[model samples]
Target: MTDATTRGFIGQLAQGDRQALLSEGVEQIFPARSALCAQGEIGTRVMLILRGTAKVGRTLSDGSHTVLGLCGPGDIVGEASAVAGEGSARLAAVIAVDSVTCRVLAASRFRQVLRARPEIYRTLVAVTNDRLRRTADNGVRQAAHPVACRTARMLKELAARYGRPAPQGLLIGLALSQHDLALLVGASRESVVRALSRLRTSGIITTSRRKIIIRDPDGLGRAGEHH
Candidate 1:
């Protein structure tokens, strides 16, 4: 069994167990704006994020991009692609939102590890299911909520999942632009701008450059729950 101290999609495993998984993989670093893989591009590897943030999204017919979700440390990218067997292409593009470090595992080698450790395979299944549930939840929220509410919900989730303390309040450590927020919320840039304006006026949040500080988390949570 693995210890509880190791947190991630794969859960905590002994050092030897972790090394066993990484034995067949190579570590690499990606700078911000680097693309790990693009939708429809044939791929042969999966990446396990060791540090930093990444954005998973797809390009639309109009050439605009929609952010599906944010992937932070301990997240996996290109898992589906790797599972698609030989000659499979990506379903979405994974881009480094910030400098990222990850372990790149070849499809065959990844399967080898899973075959050697059934527990790891079971953990992967659980993680994949959880990700699906979260994606579905996000879809429902995006479809049912107003822009302001959705924006607040998104920010709240980000802050809870990846925030750090700041003098103002909780700072979402990820460098997300208004455009990125709009994409995540399925809103227009102008709509997001207006929503942010309202939040700032209400003292729920404050922004400087690309950084956002949540001054009132309780109020923000209320906004998200208001429907």
Candidate 2:
């Protein structure tokens, strides 16, 4: 199954298995804001998200924060830490973006499952590789491209991810606040505002409240072109 199907179907299978597993060590947690991995915690655990979102960020010198990325439902967190033992939490914190439903899989059982079903392991590797590639590509874009270009590119990517066909074209459901938009585009909130207004004036996009309607998909695509 692809990312879309894998995320959609597995949630439906063995409807009761998730609940049963939740009670036996492989439990669920709806952590409050700013939840760091517990001290002296075992590294052999997997977090399967059922809903909501979290920020994976590492602390920096001088007390500033740099977000590694945002993760949501169907994402598996704790992989890096789970893989590398005898280390402090590699990630500084996993803060709840909203209330989240998650199942914890014991590290040992996770490995056993993988050993028994090597095919799943192969798929996991492929998924991880693709994600890593995208992350590297995004970092390069942030470093090399102008914010206007990056913002346009990110909008198109998000549209493809969450968009549905509409008479107007693709309706991107990204209701990102200025700060959030800035984070993705690597721009100041003021720059985001200016770029968005300029795009609107140019007939490339239309924004209503938080929703963005792409009036000219090709134009928007060009605006976000990396090269």
Candidate 3:
């Protein structure tokens, strides 16, 4: 399979299986800043993102929120809890970062489909394992890296996953505030702002409003490695 085909839940599916899965769910639109799934709630359904972006995160014991990851088109959210069976609490919150379209399936029905399609189920398991591995890597980076290095690595990741070619550089498709970056990298907002400023000053990136463009990806990568 191509890299794209193996990356996300929907992408991993065969054409017929993709259509069959979507046919079993209802389409729903979630507005920006709304919660698609809240942490700690007993999840009843899973959502397959059809368009736009969402932030997957959780509130800590001290009531501070940390961003776990970002999900965009073709990604699946809430499947872990949904597959864990009826009474399992959601492990994270999925909030719409922009207006998002999703295919929503009841947990029970989702499980039924999985049971009937072993291949699809296996693909889902692989996707889940990949996510877990990335999460663990992010944890290790947070513990070892400086804010600037972590910020550079995070921007590199975002650019690879969601960037599009533009006149200036690769424009990150997702709109993100500095606060979002801070939460994602486990740094203070002020520290993230400083890191961004350093990157901007170095001509490695440019930002306007909530948009960011990578002007010098090679330089950014070097910064991530050196610091």
Best by lDDT: 3
In model 3, the runs with Cα more than 4 Å from the true position are 1-7
How do the candidates rank by TM-score, highest first?
A: 3, 1, 2
**TM-score of each predicted structure versus truth:** 0.84, 0.72, 0.89
Worst 10 residues of 1 by lDDT: 1-10
Whole-model lDDT, candidate 3?
Answer: 0.87
Listing every candidate in turn, what is its Cα RMSD in Å to the true structure after a full C-alpha superposition? 3.4, 4.9, 2.8
| Candidate 1 clashing pairs, residues 3+ apart or interchain | none
The candidate with the higher lDDT, 2 or 3, is 3
TM-score-better candidate, 1 vs 3: 3
**Candidate 1 Cα errors over 4 Å, as ranges:** 1-19, 22-24, 60-64
Which digits, one per residue and each the tens of the lDDT, describe model 3 over residues 1-227? 33223336788798888878878879899999999999999999989888777999889999987789888777888899989998999988999998998999999999999999888898899888988887898899999999999999999988877677899999887768888889888899999999999999999999998799999999999989943
- Compared with the true structure, model 3 gives a TM-score of 0.89
Clashes (backbone N, CA, C under 3 Å), per candidate, total: 0, 1, 0
Which lDDT value does model 3 have at 2?
31
Write candidate 1's Cα lDDT for 141-164 as tens digits.
877889888899989988876677
